[model samples]
Target: MKHGRALTITITLLITVLFAVSAGCTGPVQQPSASPAVTAPAADGSSLVFTDQEFAFELRRTIGASYAGEADIGECLATASRIQEGDFESWYTEWNRTADAFRAAGDGSLAAGHRVSAMEAYYRAATYYRTAEFFLHGNPADPRIVETWSKSRDAFRDAIALDVVPYEIVAIPYENTTLPGYFYTVDDSGISRPLLIVQTGFDGCQEELHPYAMEGIRRGYNVLTFEGPGQGEVIRVQHIPFRADWENVIAPVVDYAAGRPDVDEDRIALWGISLGGYLAPRGAAYEPRITALVADGGTYDVGQNLLQNLQEGGGAPANLTEDDLQEWLQTDPAEFNDAILGAMAHDTGTRWLNENGMFVFSAASPAEFWAKWMEFSLAGIAEEIRCPTLVCAGAADHFDPDGVQAQALYDHLTCERDLMVFSDDYGAGSHCQLGAFAQSFAAKFDWLDDRMGMSG
Candidate 1:
């Protein structure tokens, strides 16, 4: 019912390009007995295949909490600083060398100094993503936002797959080495890809998978990225509305993924961005079979977030006119009445931006705000995440919760959960900005690789 990242879209997806963020792997996976291929498709639209390097890298990058990544942190940091400080050329010049440095360091252990250099590379790319998001534009209703996010997602994926962690600058053989990894060990004939449960942010949907989802598939994972009830296409086209019990809603999604025989039951993981950060955790809390959980730039308390945004907007009411409500009331009171009232409540910022049925984001009414807020709080269920977890946030993120929720969630994890927060201080983006995203993603995958013992 309040403003959110959707507002910051500055009106499109092509805001910027390039972005980044990672960790370690422990052992090699023994080949499984031959079977049949699952319904999964690799990036090439064929069965999954993996070389050992690709396998190690793919798992390493999956979790999003890595302290290790593929790029040079110091170099990445410098490049990003140049771009943000208004020097694209300098950033590019430095980035080229840093990129080469990462290739040279490929699959090797990273010394702290080398790691810092790698971070610089990732940082620069991440900054680029933010630039594309904020500066480039078309319309929120157009493909720009989608295109920009896709780029941002890929940038982060790049950072993770490069050579090292951008923030910590530690060199380790981890997910950071994936290079947009190819994850299958055997041909796709008999193997099912890992089950990746992807969910969108506040206004995002399946198409949002472009960058990150694409990376996952390249690494041999069968990804199922979806729009929650009130998000992007789900709400706009499908007309599904938001609900309080977000986790409950996702339960069926998990079941749907699990029902697929090709899906590795032991490898099912929930990956969510922004709002999905909270939603994914909630789902894991309610359902324990979730093998892994990645909540990126998550919102911890909906009530707190909603209230903050509203207060920022001067507590003004929606854009809906009284007359519109009267006309809809002529229809049945049960369905049409509420629908009309929602239509009349048009001025809602991020909840839904529709002037007719729903704007894009908004509480049907303020009266329903607190009720929904209390339902999404992480206090009760965050700890229920029993699988290894990766919780990420942008320290200076304008698009998400600024790491408050992620910090809280990370602190409470009983499993091997890692929390990483990024900002200019750490050389990252604002919210889901490409700048911060690259580092954020690298950090997450690095952490995941470590937990999975993928570090060589």
Candidate 2:
């Protein structure tokens, strides 16, 4: 769900146009492929295609102790089996049902004075609820969207209340509103420690950042995971849209972190995941206070990658310039929305893409959404980053294969930088190394440890 590239309306329109042309000449039209053409092999040495790709990747994400337990796994797999591929309703129903079961179990445990059991169950329930709402992007007003997310948030709050480590709910002041966050430390040792400010990319919420926070805490780091503009509660509750000026978002977070006695002001690190690959670097470019930065599965230029995918998938003209595309994106909003809706009628991917993009970016139409995302590139600003940076990528990443964005980012950085590529042989070649989080975490945190000089 943490997507690095934009889902452009141009591609959807092109697909719709192409389908019409082909149908006119060749008789009845064929259905789009159920799965994406490019399939990545799973960590278990099996290739996952189409709808299975996302489900399998998510399963990998929750496999470790940072997210799920054995009971959670059983429930998730059972629910996954019951859901139909690319069917949003089925996906939501099954996961929500499992989450409800876990919620009940957690409540029972709490009533029986079993705090540990309650914590574990509540955490898993929160994760399940988050997953349930992942694909429900068609309607912002859908009561289920807010209801499921609220359940996830409340369950996470319950789990955090019982945490052995110190956990505090924080409200980081943004422009006019406060960003919601959770600050986690390994202990209340009253020692100033290296701090990690964690941000997730498109489609990820702060509740899903627990694994990264847990990893940092185990490595003697204080972690602050927050939902920024266009993410999680900020978007759902505050109605804030995504912005390209991530520095505005991060500067306030850094200000809040610096004020905390438990955080070492001199050793603060900023980490961004998925589309955050572009965001973290963009922030580090403007916010010089950050001592170190990490882009998990680095993304250099989201617009450029989107154009490439459009060319490949829709056979759009390859010679199109950004300016030219922008001009086309300035089409009448009504016309653009009509095209998007027409495309969405036939293509499931197009429907989800348009719905998700419109909701997150707060665009009135497809043209506005496409135009807004054009600024999400790190083309000219990557060189402005002045901190020790780590750029991570997976060799077979469908999102950024062969470290395309990571390598570009490393090449652009004028400061000390490291590029770590996860290989397919290690079963870590998917985006963000989904199936190999432990290995990815070890590599990422080890680099941070060396840079921050954390004593073992």
Candidate 3:
């Protein structure tokens, strides 16, 4: 399969992503209001479709990359057609098969001396492999997690090698070891340019940020994307869990970028996606060297929101605070955990969020996970930020449906700030605008360009 392979797609269903649910919360897992009920269509339909909202959203995520060759429209539709909604095994099997097919296609294209075709095929393979591994984190011990992730990384590396622009897989020195990153430059002209540093939030890899980096590179910026503790290779290979003090992570990354001759140290910008919406802002609060910060859908207080969700849903009492939550857990952790576990049993998104949180946060159980989650707040720190910041939100954000988190973060800012909320009318209202890359990139880079005085 190749790019632009007879593709016509649309977000026919309204799907919403979920935030973690607190133990006391009681409600059906929140999702977007569905359109009129209809059977999921065949692959050759006007668009690849899914009746399951999560399935539909994720499938559209891959298909959206068709413009850049990270995904092929025909292949995504064909693979998605065979997978059963909410069936992890089926999802994994179909995507894995497609990945292997693309990988083989790339190898054959390379042998035929078709570098462009090889690059496109490898890109598709990498994305498919990543998609295959998406739901496996629920079982932390699953061997397929590492194997599929490795294939994705390897395929991405191979694809980047064939790019016309310069790309480097870098290992930046951290505490005791090195953090993996990919650096892309507009050119090797030995001229320093503004740099954009990016990291994905929980459950995303550095390789998946390739299209984001390409956006910067095309707009006369050098891009450096890395995975910190609890993310990408750091968590998978080094066994490092996430730390709330993100400045410790961002500072070292800044040091590395500042030392590079090709990076303009004065114009370094940081972007955090999804959960990173919280992480990047926390980093900027303490790291004064950062020139600008972008939180793609701001997250103010994760634990608070989770608990508040419970409160609103009648799971917990009114005005529940962190201290109250901790006291409840300490009083009878087993009982508290049972409530959370029961809730997780009903919601796939909630289960994955907590399970993945436990693994990445190094919490022993649900109670412990929520305890640690409380520390990821920007309560007193937001006002400390010195750099201009951009806080984005989806009008119908699955994780922040009310848009309160982004508004809170914006309100707390004492520095120069702007809030951009994407509306669903443009198909850019999903989490981080997953299915609308062009709109998301344009809004983000345009803001950064103006902030850095690089706007044309």
Q: In model 3, what is the error at residue 189, expressed in angstroms?
A: 1.8
In candidate 1, where is summed lDDT lowest over 10 consecutive residues? 17-26
Q: For residues 341-398, what per-residue lDDT tens digits would candidate 2 score against the true structure?
A: 8877776646665677788999878678777877777778888888888877665665
The lDDT values for all models are: 0.44, 0.73, 0.76
Global lDDT for candidate 2?
A: 0.73
TM-score of each: 0.49, 0.86, 0.88
Q: Give per-residue lDDT, candidate 1, residue 400.
A: 41
- What lDDT does model 1 reach? 0.44
True-vs-predicted CA distance for residue 421, candidate 3, Å: 0.6
TM-score between candidate 1 and the true structure: 0.49
Task: In angstroms, give how far residue 267 of model 3 lies from its true place.
Answer: 1.0
lDDT, residue 142, candidate 3: 85
Ranking by lDDT: 3, 2, 1
Candidate 1 Cα misplacement greater than 4 A, ranges: 1-190, 305-362, 366-374, 399-402, 425-427, 433-437, 452-456
Model 2 TM-score (2 dp): 0.86
